[model samples]
Every structure is written in structure tokens, then in C-alpha cells.
Target: MTSRKAEEIQHEGASGGWGSVSGMAKVLLREKPTPASLDTLLHQNKPHGFMCTSCAWGKPKHPHKFEFCENGAKSTLWELTSDRCTPDFFAAHTVTELLGWQDYDLEMQGRLTEPMRYDAATDKYLACTWDEAFTGIGATLRTLDPKSVIFYASGKSALEQSYLYGLTARFYGNNNLPDSSNMCHETTSVGLKQVIGSPVGTCVLEDFETCDVILYFGQNPGTNSPRFLHPLQEAVKRGCKILTFNPVREQGLVRFINPQNPMQMLSGHATELSHMYLQVRPGGDIAAMMGMCKHAFALDAARREGGEDGVFDRDFIAQHTSEFDDFAAKVHATTWHDIERESGLTRADLEAAADIYATAKNVIAVYGMGLTQHVHGTQSIGMLVNMLLLGGHIGRDGAGACPVRGHSNVQGQRTVGISEKPELVPLDVLARQFDFEPPRDKGMGTVETCEGILAGTVKGFISLGGNFVRAIPDQEVVETAWSAQAITVYIATKLNRSHLVHGKASYLLPCLARSEDDVQASGSQSVSMEDSFSHIHGSVGKRKPASEHLRSEVAIVAGIAKATLPPNPTWRWDEWTADYGKIRDLIEATYPDQFKDYNARMFDAGGFYRGNPARERDWKTETGKARFTTPTVLSAVGVGDAPGRYHLITMRSNDQFNTTIYGHSDRLRGLEGSRAVLLMNPQDIERDGLHVGDVVSLVGDAGDGAERSVGGLTVTAFNLPSGCVGGYYPEMNPLMPLWYHDVDSKTPAAKGVPVRISAGKKPT
Candidate 1:
């Protein structure tokens, strides 16, 4: 055993000099310098090979020499690693033994080599052939009520695979398709459509260049979407004002260093990214936005009285919007005292922010999980749209709503019709094309899926690539619900905690990674994906497969479809798998307006932009124009008078992406060797009578009447607000109740979890 001093972890400015370079190098060192590793890194985000599986941010039209970020490199190396998990490896460990392993440890064991079937008697996963696994799954699905079966898609699945998955579900006469988007961006989809007549973003990547002001509300781009930093850094160089409003002062928002720029690396001086950083309280984004709009309305009134041009865009409002009168009246009625109490920012601070927006000619607004994972997430987005519409900072160059996506192909999945509602095109078109009437009934989303699991309505579950057990809220309840299923099928690449929480019958189908070569009867194939800005592009894998037994995601879906379907000519699973170009043909045929000449445009170096009418000044809304909504004023729900109660927010560490953990260290936040630390304000620590490194137990205060608690969490002082605390998720996910969700979108209130922290574990 080695003994040494506890090394203090140093937090640096986001991505510069040796920090980012060393971080990338460290991941490669652990996996050990493989030739394919370098090849995959060079081929990433290039026209010649596959896109980066890390993020959905668009790549430059011309492309860079190294078109990936530190996290991107980590994700690529993780997929291309030489390590393998064979059947022998599983034979040695029981399911009970593997249950004790950490999430990071499970993924680090490397790519799964073959298919597996759970044996409850031995509590072990035994080896099985692909045909046997598919036959069993098919037989089980044939017997169950189609409405009781649910299909789930992960964000990383290619559009070709997602299209087939959706088709298979519809062919089987159910639309129970719940995706990862239901967890992260469901609010963006539901809210944007309600306000702007579109579910996708209105701005492209290039808009970052010309926007004068960018309001980054409730988002941390530095760690979540690092490629966004390039555009932000360039925007700052051009004298654009970047404003941040979040509970914690994230280091990425404070300053950024460009590792690719040699002069900046040599100078060792980081560029200040944000003009102003307001540390709003947890669940305070809605209140802060409302305050800004109220102040802007006041500024407009005062300007008109002085006989000057007012900030209101009267021409644009008259020609392109509805419900302006009612929205304006609500803004006038909101009180300053309520805003200040909820937002944790003074009236003056809101006025200052309003002044910045009033002076700017063009502005862009971007947000992430902070705005979406709330009880009032849909209303929060409406408030954002109301403010932007006040000054006509939309439907023009460098001005629009941009809800930056966290996952690589989440946007792509939605674009290709991975939805609970399959009404992208009319039923007539789908019926004529596929010879089957698609299900018109509304289906389950992530939250509704949890409800289905608990109520015993959903008896069968099939996941394309996500760890559903860990990703969903209400950990204990979800585990029980998942175990109660008759059959559960997971098409995955590696071992996850979800595999351990199995049903009566479980099947683990291993698939090829995005960076690996996928060969079929039609030769090498490339999969298409849409970026956050709605640009659809093709990605071809260049590296060899990790295992000979591993198959492509498309092949697995096709095999299952072939085994299950009732033998119809129109449902040609084999033909679709023969050539993915044929899949593009079907997509284009179904939606001619959006996917015209899909195959031809797919190979274009810059990719093709899927048109957005909202960005082009086209209104397809109910009122034939953008609509302004008068959202209700909701105050921050305090922890009440309880001594140790606090507003707790769940967050992802810099080292992890979603539930996939790459390492134990979070370099950006200076956390290492552990992930169970709670970040709280020093003042809150004093008020609660706790010091650093004190183990505590946390219980939910949502009044759900269900017991929700997490224990063995160590307290750490952070620069958070007085009443706000932070904890890493999946670990803290148990504290979130299943019923605490937005009524409109069914997205869980992840960012607004109210918790009471106390020393020692709870009594049994």
C-alpha cells in the first residue's frame, strides 16, 4: 500500500494551456496509446468519418484540424478503448456482487463482447446467441398487450436506427416511445412550440458571430457543451456582452482560455467571458426573467414620455405577434418586492440587466437543464420568449431562442420522428408508404413511463441505449417497478447498473460503437444526425469493431423487427438494413418538405439545414404569428422554517456525461477521489451548524408522502447562494419524487428539489 499526503485539487480557468491538453492525454494514457485511438480522434467531426458522440453542437462548415473538445476526446477514447468484457468475465461475478460495483467501475471494465441472458437461479448473466435472444424477446412481445410495451431511445442513437425503432413500435400497434429528450429537453420542445410555433431552436451556430448580446440564463456551457466556448470566446473578442444568471458562479462562465490559440496559451491570460454574473437562487430563473421584462417595460414608458424612440418594437409586434396587450399588463402588474425576494437579485440588478438588453440591437438567448428541469419549466420558457419579443430580438440575424442540447444526437432523434406522438406527417402519408395505420393515441414520456411502470400498466420495456433505471427519478420506486416487468430488453454497448436491476426475463444485446466500422450487405454505411441548430449531416465510422460478435444498432433493431412482425411486404426490415440510403428515401418520401433529396444533401461537406419557419420569419402558429403568454408569478419555494432545510439542485460533474462516468475527477470544479460531496454556501453551513467534510443525511420536503432520502453525503463549502445547495446526480436522484413534475411537459423538477440536510444517518 502507498501512503502520501492528500493532494489539493486545483480548479483552473476553463480549458486552456496544459489543463485541457493534459486532461485529454490522461484519458488516453489509461486506455494506452492505440493506433485506432489516434485515427478515431483525427476522424471525429470530419466528413470522412463519424461525428463526435459528445455533444450536438454544430461543427464549422470549413472544419478545424482538431474538431473536438477535451470531453469529446474522452468520449471517443472511451469507445475506442482496447479493453473488453467477455462472457468469462461475467461468469466469475454474480449479479449480487456486481450490484455493489460503482457506476464508473462498471463502464471502465470495457465494451461487452456478446449477448447475455439473466439466470435468476444463479444470479448471473449467462452467454446466449443473438437469434435465441431475439426469438425470446419476439415471443414475449407477441403475447403481451402492445399498449403495455414501451420503447425507449437514447440520445446517442443515429437517425437511421431511430427511424427504424419508431417504425417498429408503430408497426406493433403502439406509440409508447419515450426518449432521453423527455428527461432533458422536453420543456424546450413543449415550450418552444407553445410560444414560437416550433419545437426546435430558431438560431444557427453562425448567429453567435453577429449577436451583440447573449443572455446565458440558467446554463453552464463550459462543462456541458465545451464547443460552445469557441463561438463565445470569439464573440467576446468582438466586444459582445455575455451575461450569466445561475445559482453557483461556474468557473467556465467567469473566464475561458483557448487551448488552440498559441499566443493566448503563451500569454497565460484568460479572456473574461461574462460581462455580469448574477448568482440567482435555485428555481429563480422565472422570477429574474419576469423582473427584467417589468423593468424593460418601465424603461420603454419613460423613453416615450421624453419624446424619444421607445424600446418597444411596435412595427414588429403589430405584424408578427398576438396577445401582447395581456402580456404587457401582467408585466406591469408584477411587483418589485416579489421579484427581489424570489430572484435573490435586487431591483437595481434587474434594471441594470434590462438596460443592457434595451441598448443592444440584436440578442441571442441560450439555456440548458437549469431552465428545463423544473415544475414550471414550460412557463419559464414563455417568460424568456415574452422578454425577447418585447424588443423584436427574434426572427432575424443573430437574434433568436437557442436551447443548447446536451446530448449528441438528441435533436437528430426527434427530427427523424422518435416521439410519443407520431403526427410529424399525416396518417395517410404513413399508411400509403408503410401500409400500416400508425398509432394515433398519445404515448408515454419519461415521467409517464415511470408512472406506467409503477401502476403495472407497462409490462414490457425495450431500451435502445440508455440506462433507464439510473436516469429516471425516484430510484427505489423505479427499481421496484422495473423488477416487476415481465420482460426487459437492453441494446447497449457496456455493462450498467440498469442491467443488474433486471425483470423476470432480461436480455442484454451488445451493439457496435459509433466510431467502429459498420458493414452490411450494401457495404460500409454512414448514419445521419441533426445538430442542435437543425443541420442534418452524415457520419461514417472508420475504426474496426471492438468485438466480432458485436452488431450495429440498425441490425439489432431490424433483426428484432423481422422476428416479431407478421410478415408484410411493406414492412421490409431486411431491405431497410441492406442500404441506409433506402431509409433516407423513406424519410424523404414521408416528409417531402423537410427531407427533400435527403441522400444527396447528406454527403455535402457542410451538411444540410433542416428549415425552421420561425427563423425565416414564417408563422405557422394558431394565430398565424408568434404568441406572447402572460405567465403567472411563482415565488421561490423556501425550505420553510426548518433549521437545516435548503433548496437543493442536482448537477453533473465535469468528468461525466449524463450517467456515463469517465473518471473519478471533476477537474473544472476541483473535485477528485469522490463524488458524494454536497456543495453549500459557507453562510448556510454556519446556520446549519455544520463544517466541511461532515457526513449527513438528506430527505425531501416535497410533501409527496413518500419517503425520499439519501445518506452518507459529506458537506463542503462552496460559493453558492445563502439558501441553495448542490449535489451530484444519480446519487441524489433518489431524493426527487416521481410525482414532482411539470404538468405541461412531465419533466421532473430536478433543479428545484427541496431537501433537509442533517448530521448522521436516518434511523430505520
Candidate 2:
């Protein structure tokens, strides 16, 4: 039978309400013409195609005939759709008219076919030649102060493209580089940088197979990273203990049927994933970890008292770690009462989790945005590291901290020197390699970029790819700053809200998608992506270009550099754009030991695994050891108001990844058609005298005396914490105050917004 018919048979056997499958079945079962109708309904299949930009749910390491998730499939279908945004389409519609459309609606319009320039007079966008657009952009940049320009790169760009963009920006004498990492895993980087002297994860994907125990913290692999689910499933089947700690009970964590496995899919057999589940309160991750560590220390002490060596790795601690006395003292000083109250988990639960860790020979701690989007997000990650260090879990088979990255190449971007503060060695090497004195002074991060923009120090923005306006906190302030820019250049595949919030002279430069072949003067090109496991793999596209006029991000950056920068004697932009191998050589030269044969190694099966200091149990610090950070105040919790208001935790739907929505459906939560809904505990609803589907207004201070409120939200009471409310982000981002951010990392406390929920009609 056809794919549609097979999917229908599978969906019937699968659990309740498969939205995408049901939607597909409706189209398939409908009566119409035969082959002709199918041809009309389906988009043209092009060679070198098939890449999903929506979620990071990639195909497995080993190939499968059908390897894609529900969200991934939707993203693929959307990317491969026949819809086209031609020059005539823009000529017919005004920018203002397009601004009125929904985010999903705008993107569904299809890939932009040509370069477009904003027309202030007609309030419309007009077609512009590539050279004209570049020249205009260059002129705007030259007019502005170098510090005024903000170069924002996304994870979608290739290594060559990202390196070129960074080169152009730094060469122009500014480092206001803000990327998608600012929104998702900036806290992880900041946290790990302070503790481990590195920003990326320390483990490889193969480690999962051998891990004795896997502890998941506030991450849902089934939706966020579906490819991870299979490995997790295999681990569970092999009797590896799987533990999950999150406010909500994610379905994927409980059990998942591998869609790619024919036997499993046909037989409807699902593997039980999580052996133990602990629902910790929102923003209480640090407390939970501290509690577990405290219990483990007690157990170790008891074992020592009995004249036997405890489970703790004393040799590793003495050889590879520092500040053990302080770390142990803090844990010993912390009372069980404080841990229970702060974590919202009982002493017994913490003890049980500690017991499991103590028994497991190999353990892997995995976390996501939930642990990194709080007031003390960075501190939370440090606490987790402290826990891992206590048990000597570092640099072993299947043992290390794994921070699941949202985007595909976020790690690779950071790897290729797309950082706010460049490392000393890289900076020195880049200067020597390019024959220019690179800026020794540090530059702007996400928070700093916002501050610069608002202060009018930043006058221009060149976004490689991303919805920077919508993704950042305080939408009103961000949009206002964006509008005030002298020039805002967006190099993207499709339209987003960022394109609508234009500057004085905005230009949208359409580029080829990542899955599309990049055939330049040098021939076909391949981009490298670093997975969460620190494996650097090559992803070459096999699909045809969306449009003939579209250029690769590398070429676009090169073109802009040629227009803007003076001809550099040392670096040749044209040569680098011609072949990505040349860029790899530069990268390898910059970091000699790390990327020895960067080009050749990337082409090897399974790619090259970058060395993580933590993985080697070799602490790269001034003291030459993994220093255990002392927990000064574990009870200093940031919750909502006193006995009345509840804390609002912003989350993403199952069908959504970051700010990119695959569709308007939350399969796990059972919500359909819309994303404007709040989840609360049934007890909280009863105590507050609220009912299901009751319209409520969530009010919070926007700034000054102004209050930002999202009204007309249906309150659906579920199994969430008593005093906590969970809602989707971007929609609920208005409730997050601009000034309210982590002091250390400067990441917005999106998970801990204090709001007074009331029963009434929402104010317009």
C-alpha cells in the first residue's frame, strides 16, 4: 500500500489522537481524481532535497528507509512545498499587509525567490539586484560607527558561512555577535565555562549505549530530540536505569515505539523508558541536585565509618579535582528540611535517587532549557557538575554531563570562534593567521547586545538566520530597538517576524537552504555539524536549489565582505568561499591539537570526536583540577508571590522547537487548534475557585507602571505543581519583564515569572 495507507494502519494501533497522521489520512481518504490529483496535491520532488529546519530531530547515526519524526516530517513537507514567494507576490502585497498575517501563515507562503529591498514610500518591498542590495548595505555600514553594527548568526549556517560572517564582522571592528544560543543554552555555556573551562558537552553519542544509568533533567527527548529516544530505548532494553526529573510527565520519557523499526511499528510494541520519574517543582533543579549530593555524601561517610571504601571515586577526586573540603562541608551543612522545602521533593525521594547513583558504575546526566532558563540557571548547571564530580562520574565510559543543544550547528558555531569573548589562543592565532591585530577587548553577548541596541550604540544588524526579534525577551523593547536601526540585513531561506520589524533601510537576502547543494566556483560543498556528543559530522545536501538566484550563506557573507571591507592581503574571502576545505585548514591551524585533520576526519565514518577536558578527567584550570563549587545558599529560591500569586513557567509544545512551531498541535498535552492555554494543578484550580476552560488574565509588570497581560487563556488544570502555571513561550514571553534575568548569565527567568491569575474577561 501507499505511505499514507500504511501510516493510517499504524496510527490506529498507536495511542490516541495522532494529529498529523489524522490530517494526512483525511487528505488521502478524500474522493478526487486519481494520479493527476495526486500530482497536483503533492509538491515536486527535487534531487539533493530533504532537510527539516523545525526541530533538531535528525535521522539516526545508521540510516533508516524512513527516519523522521512527526514534527520533522511536517518541517520537510513545508520546506519541500511547491509554494513560492516571487517578486510579483511581494509587488501585490504590502509589508504592512504581510505583518498582519500569523507567523505560521507568513512562513507557509514559501521560500523567497529573490532579493527584496524595503520601500518606505509605498510601505512595500521591491525587487533589488544582489549587487545593489550589497552596495546599499555596505554604504549603510560604512556610514554607521563600527560598534553600532550587531552581527547575529543562527545555527542554520554552515561552518564556512559562519566563519566568513564572523571574519567580516570582526574585520569591521565590532563583536556584537548574538546568536540562537542566547535564547536556549547560553546558561549552559556560561555555567560550564566557569566550572569546566569549556562551553560544550564532554560526552559522545556512543557513551549512551554503555551508560549504567541516565538521569534526565527537565528534557523531553521524544519531541526535542527524537533521535536520542532510540538510543535511550536501547539502553533501557539493556537494563540501564533511566531516571527523569521534570515538572510535567512527558509521554516520551515513559514509553516510545520506534517508528523506524518495522517489527516494533507493526507489532505495536512500546519500550518502557524511564524506570523512575520525579516531578520536581519548576526552577527547583539546583535544590534537587544539592539534596541528592547531600545524601550521597552521607552514604559515603557511613561506608568509611564501617572501614570500607565508599562508592565515591577518591582517587579521581584527589588526582583530578579541587575544593573537595568546601564542597563536602556545604553539602553536610545543608539540612534535609531546606532541601525538601526548596525542591518540593521529599527527603526519601532524594535519598532514593542518591542510592541509585551510588549503585550505578556509569552515569550520564542530561539536561535541557528547563534547567537553564531560571534565575540561577548557570548556578544550577554548576550544581549538577558538583554532583557528578562528587561520585567521580567524569571522563569515563558513558559518564559525563550532556546538554542537549536545540539547533544542529550551535556547538559547531561556537567551535569555529563565533563567540562574544574569543579564547586567548584562538584570538592570537586568528590575528597571526589573518595578519591583522584582532581586537583584544571582549565584546557584546545577548544581554550586552540588547543594552547596546537600546543605548543607540548599535545602529545596524546583520542576522545570518533566526527570528531575533521574537526569540529575545521584552518583545516591545527589542522591536523598538530593531526599528531604530539604520540598516537591518536578514540572510534567510523564508520570511519570519524578524523581517517584518524593519529598520530605516532593511534588505532581505534570500539564501539556499542547508539541505540544498552548494555548487560554487570550486564545485559542491559540505557543512559540518557538531552533535551533543561532541562528534563533528559532515552534512552534504543532495537537493536542488529552491531558486536559481539564491546563494549559499558563505557566498553571501563573502559578497558583503567584498562590498564592505578593504581587500586584506592575508585573508582571501573569494578563495575560502570557493572551497570549504581551506576554511577547515584555517580552523585546524587556529586550534592545532583539537582539530588535527579537521577536513579528513570529518569525512570519516561517524566523524571525529572532539576531546572534552572533563571526558579525560583532566581539569584544565589554574589549579589543574575539577574544582567543586561550594553551595553557599541552596534555600534561596525564587518562586511567585506570598500565598496568592503563582509562578508562571513558559514551555514549548510537543509540535514546536524553540520559537519555530511545526503546527498548532500539542500531542502530549492533548491541545489542538491553538497554543494559548495554561496548565495548572487540579488542587490549585480548586483552591483558586477556577474551572477548566475558564478565561483568565495573567498580569505582570512590563516596565514602569505598564502591565503586560495575556488574556482569554483557557485554564486547564492538570498534574502541574500546586502554585505553578505552565504556558507556551513567545506567547507568554510578554509576562517576562526585561529587567528580570539571571544576574550571572543574563538569561531571562522565563520559567519563574510571578503573576496574579484572576478569573475574568481579558482586557483588550
Candidate 3:
């Protein structure tokens, strides 16, 4: 037998061992924090400590002494650094010149200490008082039509800040509220809600304990959420089965050593994570799922033919689901040939996976952007739900859907009404509570917001903390759209690419980080945030403000609202901003069932879980039952017409979180000193008449007829599936046209873009 060692050929790392601990220690040392700072950093996710501002995986009910992950340590230390970006730093650099700096360099300049405004004449950001900045922003916004202004939020903000942000936008007579959710999990929300009548996942963290099988459709949990490995480790110890389906063999899913375990750290022994791994092609989740179901469906048919029972869950389908007949018909009609062609998996391989899934009493289907950043992302989510419903796995302990969220409070921000298309119930509640009617007009999401800016319809943009310009697709188009804006305001803690990509009039209003104390009229405030599993908890910052000039996001939102809107008695912006408890009271009054006793319950140990009807086996869909969807195959459309073209999926390096580049090196991928490289299969390289280390230019083929390309990316042979290559995002984002996005959810198809690659230059 030919020995094709997976680990030797491809770069791999058993995540979370001494390496993680050393990395964490280095980050703390580089930040030069005090003993108290180290203490606070270690307790970042504990009961009273501030939440880690990284991924949104829920914290354990009983957290260990050290629950922070490697990335979490980086994120918090990055925020709590002693270095400061004072007004002198801004006065020394021009926006035009600063644009040439790399993202990591820009962020490493440290936290923003004061407000700064763009002076077009001087071409530099001049120091300005908070009042001056807000007044100027308000004046520019007031001059434009309310519909031309868009309010955006980031996932870092607490629920109180996001609530105030929404109210500010609505009271200003605009509904164009967009946020980070649109860029990542909008498909999860849109698809799950259409089928299950809710946007959240049905399973909690405890489900991993009892789940017989864990099916990872696309997520790479090691880099995305390292803390998630603890539970998976525990599950593996119990001999639970883990199946991973992705285009690449992610090392994090293959092997992981718990950094928190002293014995494991001392022994240097790693736990094998995935027992079964499938290299599903990019944009192949739908067909792969269908192929697995095809085998299960056949087994159920044979059992029925033999007059046997219980393989198909007939009772659950009849009582808790609808449209199973149509779903089954479509599943049966999908041939194995098409499945193999689309999924890049043989029928035998899929059947083996299917047998494992079918034999398991309880299974959990966990996925990430790989399944949600495609043209058919919504349909793909429905397919996963259908598979779970087919086996009667849902509504049971350790069995349901789990879409891993990438932001700390992305879900929580949406829960507090940071949506462009705000629901009517919240609108009605706000209208009654605030003595004003919110506009019912459908608003622009993240992509649409950029489109509006490019079209000159949107004149003002306000972000409550995000690198908006770097986060979206079509970098050139976004830059043009941002330059066209009349005013661009950012409430942020640190400087990033978005701060340099200014409009005709721009302002940077410095704000406190999640780890900073927010002193208000009611004393230090504790803000609430909802995790990926719908658990709401209070986050109280341990450190003092990074700077005395810095203000809380709540105060900034109120300041903007007071400056822009006419004074109204019922708006009560002052009262709400002064006391966040009033905001919680309003949230409770708005969503009584979901957030009943919101503030009081949040004081409990480990917080409280906001109940979901789907998890409780209560059908809440339009049909009064969980609806099964018969989705048409859509992966075939991802292929470009041109030959020698490979499908490109932009991804994050292990060192980075979202657009915030922690460093240029990706330690997990074994790349150092630079991120200007592409991972390609050796077969694809030979077929394209190219070699490793050859610089290549990628031209996107999204049927837009516009030429979009990025050059000077070095290609390296990787253990990836054929006809698929990988590129780092925010750099390759220019190749993704604004039009190439999921139709239903409006999320950029960052995971599936057809591209033609060719050699350009040799690496220096």
C-alpha cells in the first residue's frame, strides 16, 4: 500500500498544548500589564469578569479556573494593552499615507485615546473634543435625508449599547440598521427561522455531553473557538463519535490537547478528535448531506419493505414535522452520480457516514460559514435540519442544530434590534415605550448598505465598533462607496483600516472596550450579552477606562441621538443611558417571554438560558410544525465557464479573528512573516501548468462581466480537494464582486467564488 501520510505532507498542529500557553504568556508580556491585569485576563470569562471579545461559543455553566482560549487571550490583551494612540499619533499620519500600512501595523498602534476629526485641507486627523466631533457629525447627518443615513453596529457591543443604537436610528426616522450579523450568520438566521420559526440553534453546550455523534459540516473549531475543544475532549473521552466534513483536513478537528489540563500539558499527549473525516468539495454541503440521507433513506425503505419499524421516525414526522413526503421524494430522486460529482465523495464513503449517523441514537449537526457563505446557503441549512428531523434527533438531549457564531455578542446585538429588517413586535414595543413610531420600511443590510453608498443614496454612515471597510466584500467598491459618503463616524476603541478609509467628512469617537469600567449615573453598569446557545449573562468590566477621555458606547449613542433628534419628553435617552437597568426593563417589556426578569436572572451564577421552542419540541413554524424543505441542488452553479479555473474560498488564518489581524504569521499553518500566500492542491497546480512558490493572479468569474483581480499571491501545495483553492480574505476580497452573494440572505459568498489562477511573478 502506498503511504500517503496526511500529517507529513500537510501542515498540522495538535492545537492547545504548551504552545497555546506559551502564546498566551507572550501576549501578556508584550502588553506589559500589571499583576491585576493578568488576573483580570485569566478571569475574562468567569462569572463576574468581562466576556472574551472573540467568538460567541457559550461559556460553561461552571467554568474552570482558566477558561480563556488562546485567541481569547490575544483578543483581550490586544484590547487592554498599555500602549495608546494619542492625538499626536493621528496628527503625525495622514489618512492617505496611513492607507499604505498593513492591518496589523495599524491596529498595533494601540488604543484610541481621544476623538479625532478629518481635516481635508490638512489631510490629517486633527484632535477634536467629543462634543465638537458629535456636533460636526450631527450637522452633516441633519443636512442629509434621513433615509440616506445608515446605522451599523459591531458584535462587541453589549445589549444595552446596541439597544440604544437601534433607538437612535429609529428615532432619527431611519430604519437602515446594519451590523456584523449580515456578513456571517444571516443565512443561519434566515434559513432556520423559515423552517423552525426561530433564528437560534436548538442545542446548548451541554448537548455535546450526550450526543452520540457530532457532525461538523464546515466549522474549524480549533482556530475559530478553541474553548469549544474542552467539551469535544470530554465527549471524545466518553467514546463519542465525531465526523468532520470539509474540503480541507483541518488539524484542529483531527487532534487537540487541552491546554487547561495539567496532566495533558505535562504528558504532551493529544486526543484524536474526529474518527471519520470527509473531504467534501467547496459548495458541496447540500449534495454531501443528500448523499448521506440517500443511504439512510434506502435503509429505512428496506426496513419498511420487511415490515420492520423505528428506523424512520414516523410518529415524530406525523406530529412534529410537515413536508417530509416531498423532502423524501426529492432525496430519493437525487442520483448517486450527481452526488459524487457535486460532493467529491464516492457513494460507498457517503454510505459509511450515513450508516454511522443512522445507528446513532442522538446526533448533533454543527456548522459554520462554509455551509452558510454560498449562493444556496439558506437551502443548505434547511437540508441539515431536514436530516436531523428525519432521524427524530431534534428536540432531544444532545441532538439538534448548532451554527457556531464567530463574534462574542453577534447574536446578542441582533436580539437587541440591530437588524436592518427589524421585527414588528420589537418595533411596536419600541413605539409604545418611547412614544414614537418606527418606520416600517424595509432597510438595507451590510451588502445593500454598501450598494446604497456606491449609488450615492446613502450619505452618512455610523458604526458602533467594527472594521466595516475591511469586513465586507469587493474592497475597491467598498472604498469607493466609503469615499462617497458625506459623513463617516466610528465609535471604536482601536484604530483599523476603516478609520483610514474616510469619507468627505469623518470622525473617530473613542469608546471603552468590553473590559473597561463604565461609570454612569447608577454606578458601574453591568451589561448583558447572549451567547451562541442563547444564554444571556452580565459582563462587568474589571479594568478602568483605557483613557479618561473615552466614553461608554451607550453614552456615545445617546450623545449622537440628542445632537441629531429634536428633544422629546418620552424618548428618555438620558434616563436609559444613565441607567442600563432601564434598558433591561424595556427589553423585558418588549420580549416578555424570552427575556422575562432579564436583569435579575442575569445576576445568577452562569446566567440563564433563553428558551427556544424548537429545543422544547414545540413546533412553531407557519405550518404549526417543523417544515422539511426539498431544496434543489445549487453547488453545480459555482463552477465558472472557463477551463483551468478553481473555486476559491476566502478564509481566516489561525492567528486572526475576523478582520482583526493579530499577526502576519499563521502558526497553525506553519507560515511565518507573511500572509501573502494561497493554498492549492498539487494536482490543481500541475493541471494549471504552475508550481509551488509561483505568484498568481486570481480573476473572479461571478457573471458580472466586470474584471476583478488580485495579484502577487504565492501559491503553495496543500492537501486540499481538487478544483478548489484557498486565499486569505480582506486581501482576496477585492476579487469577490459585491453581486456574488447568497440571494436569500444577502451574505457575501466568501466561501464559494469561481476564479481562474495563473502565474505572475516569483516570490522575492
| Cα-based lDDT for every prediction | 0.84, 0.74, 0.85
- Predicted candidate 2: what Cα RMSD to the true structure? 5.5
Residue-level lDDT of model 2, residues 19-100, one tens digit each, is: 4355434323432213332332222111122334544432335544444455554545455455678889888888889888
| Every model: Cα RMSD to truth | 3.4, 5.5, 1.8
Quickly count the clashes in candidate 2.
5
Q: Over the stretch 1-764, how does candidate 3's per-residue lDDT look in tens digits?
A: 01343345577778889777777777778777556677777677778777888999888878988878989988998899988999998888888999999998898888999999999998999889988987988888889898889898888788888888888888988888888889999998899998988888999988999998988988888789988888988898998889899887887888898877788888979999998889998888888899988899989888889988746688898988999989988987888898998888888988999888888889999999999998788989999999899888889998999999988899988887888886623787788888888988887899889888778888888999999898888888778667878889989999999988888999999999888788989899888888999999888886978899998999999998888898889878789878999989988887899899887888656668889898988876789899999987737234433577778878888778999887765666666766888888876777677767888888887766888888888887777888888889788899887877887988888887888886797656
Which one wins by lDDT: 2 or 3?
Answer: 3
Query: TM-scores for all candidates?
Result: 0.97, 0.92, 0.98
What TM-score does candidate 1 get on C-alpha atoms? 0.97
**Whole-model alpha-carbon lDDT for candidate 2:** 0.74
Q: Top model by lDDT, which number?
A: 3
Please provide, for model 1 over 1-764, each residue's C-alpha lDDT reduced to its tens digit, 9 standing for 90 to 100: 01111112224455545677887888998866478679888867877567988889887787778888888998899888888889998999998899899999999888999999999899899999999999999998998999999999999998899988988998888888889898888888888888888998899888998999999877777678887888999999999998788886777787888888888888878889999889888778878988888888888999999998898898999999999999988888889888888889998888898899889888899888888788788888888888788889889998999998878899888877788976653557878888787888888888888888888888999999988889888988888777888899999998999988887899999999888889989998989888899888889887888899999999999998888889988888888888999999988887798889999888677678889999987877788899998877544332332555677889887788889988877777777778988887776767667767788888888766778888888777777777888999888899988877776888777887888886874324
| Candidate 3: residue 102 Cα off by (Å) | 0.4
**Candidate 3 total steric clashes:** 0
Model 2 alpha-carbon drift over 4 Å, by segment? 1-61, 65-67, 635-641, 701-706, 762-764
Instruction: Show where candidate 3 strays beyond 4 Å.
Output: 1-7, 634-642
